[model samples]
Target: MYIATYIIDIAALIYLMGLLYSNAALNTSRKKPFLIAIILTIVIILSEAGTVLTNNGSLNLRGINIVCNVLGFILTPMIPIAITLIFSRMILTTHKLLLISTFINIVATALSPIFGFIFYVDANNQYIRGDYFFVFIIVYIINLLILVIITLEVGKTNNYPIIGKLVGLSIFTIIGTSIQIVYPFTYSSWHCVTLSLLLYFF
Candidate 1:
C-alpha cells in the first residue's frame, strides 16, 4: 500500500511541476496559486516519504511525521484557493463568491491546527483518528461546492476551451476530495496523483 501511495505521490509531483510550467507559458496570473499548490504537493510527498523511510528503518529522521501532520493540516486546504485563482483567470471576472471562497480557504487552513483531527498521531506515536472527522467532510463539501460554482461561472462566460478546462477541474476536485475522505480506510494515494494530473491537463 505504501509503495502504491508513493508511486502516485511521485506522479502527482510531476504533474504539479507540469502545471506550473504550463501556467508560466501561458502567462497566467494564476501562477501564484499553482506555485502554492506545487509547494503543497512537495510537502505532502516529502512527508509521506519521510514517514515510510523512518518506518522502514532506512533513515532515522526525527520529527518527520510531525512535519507531515503540519503539512496535511495546513497546506492541503489551499487546493481550493489554487483552483479559484486558476478559474478566475480563465473566467476573467472577480465575483464576490470567489472572494468568499478564497477567504474560507484561508480561514480553514489557518484553523487547521486547532480543528483538524481527522487523522493524527498522538504523543505516544500511535495513530489516532479524530472524532471530528466529519468536519473535514463538511469542509470538503464546501470546497466542492465552490469548485462547482466556479465551473458554472466560467462556463457561462468563457469560450469552449476555458469552460472545458473548468469542467475537467471540477471533476478532478470531486474525485480528489472523495479519495481524501476514503483515504484512511483505503490508504490510497491515487487521489492526489489524479488531482495533480487534472491540474496539469487543465
Candidate 2:
C-alpha cells in the first residue's frame, strides 16, 4: 500500500510539473488554474510522504507529516476550483470562486486543530481518525458540487468537449474522495489513481 501510494504521488507530481510547463508555454486563460493545481499537487505529495514516514515509525520526520496534513486540509477544496478553471476557460467566475473557496478551506483547516475533532494522534504516536471527520467530508462534497455546477455552466455556454471531460473527471474525483471519506478503513487508492489519470488526460 505504501509503495502504491508513493508511486501515485510521484506520478501526480510529474503530471503537475507537466501542467505547469504547458501553462507556461501556452498563453491560455487556464494558467492560474494550472498553477493552483500544481500547488495542490505539491501539497498532496508532501502529505503522502508524511504519511509514509510516520507509518514507518520514523519520529524524526513526524513534524513534516503534521505540516503536510495541515497543508493538505487547507488546499483540498481548491482542487476542484482549479480543475473548473483549467478546462472551462472562464476566468471571472471560476477564478473568483477558486479564490473564495481557497480562503474558506484555509480557514477551516486552520480551525481544525481547535474545532475539528476529526483527527487526533494515537497513543502509538500515529495520526488517528477524529470525531469530526464528517465536517471535512461535507466540505469536499460542497467543493464537488461547485466544480460540477461550474462545469455545467461552462459547457452550456461554450459547448466544448473539454467541459464534458472535466465534468466526468470531477464526478470520478468526487466519488473517489467520498468513498475514502465515508469508509476510512477501506481501500480507495484505485479511485485516487484513476482520478489522477483523468486529471492528466483531461
Candidate 3:
C-alpha cells in the first residue's frame, strides 16, 4: 500500500516538475488545461495523504480525519471534470453529459458533510462509509462510460494526430478508476490519473 502511495506521490511530483521544465511550450494553448490538471493532481495528493493516514490508524486526529474525508470526497469527482475540460476543445464541445453529471457530483459532495449523504466521520474521527456510498461509484461509472462512448463515437482515432495519447489516457484512467471502485481499499487512482494527465501534457 505504501509502495503504491509513494509511487503516486512521485508521479504527481513529476507533473509539478513539468511546469518548471515544459513551461516554454506549455505556455501556449495547453497552459490553461495543464494548470487545471496540475492543480487537481496536487489536490489528489492531499486526498491520497488523508486516505493513507486513515488506513494507517495511527494519527487518529478527529478534525484532520473529517477534513480529509470531506475534501477527498469533494475532490475525487473533479478529476474527470478537469480532464474533460482539457479535452473539450479537441472534442468540439463542453460535453453536456460530463458537465451535468460532474455538476451533480459537486452539489452532492457539498451537502455530504452536512447530511452525511455520501460519508461522515464519527466522534472517533474514523472514516465511516455512508448509505449513498454507492453514489460515488455510480457517478464514476457514468463518467467513464460517457468518455468511452465518446471515444468510440467521435474521439480521435489511430489515424488522427493525437489518437494514441488520448486512447492511452482514456484506457489507463478507466482501468485505474475501476480498480479503486471494485477494491475500494487500494490507493491507485491518483497515480493513474497523474499518468493520464502526464501523457496528455507531454
Candidate of highest lDDT:
3
Residue clash pairs of candidate 3:
none
Write one digit per residue (lDDT tens) for candidate 1, span 38-135: 66666666665655555324233334554565556445555665566655653235544544543454455444445545555544444454665565
TM-score of 3: 0.78
Candidate 2, which segments miss by more than 4 Å at Cα? Answer: 19-26, 55-62, 88-105, 114-116, 185-202
What does candidate 3's lDDT look like per residue over 1-202, in tens digits?
A: 6656665666665657666366775444546655666676776677667656764365556666666766777677766655665545543365554556666766776677678778776665556677887787788777676665555444544345766567667888989978977787777777787777767766
Clash totals for all candidate models: 0, 1, 0
Backbone collision tally, model 3? 0
**Model 3: per-residue Cα lDDT at residue 168:** 69
TM-score of each: 0.68, 0.75, 0.78
* CA lDDT, candidate 3, residue 97: 48
Top of the candidates by TM-score: 3
lDDT of 2 by residue, 53-100 (tens): 674376665565556667766666667667666656554543555455
Q: Where does model 1 exceed 4 Å of error? A: 1-8, 11-25, 51-62, 89-119, 161-165, 183-185, 189-202
lDDT of 1: 0.57
The ten-residue window of minimal lDDT in model 2 covers: 185-194
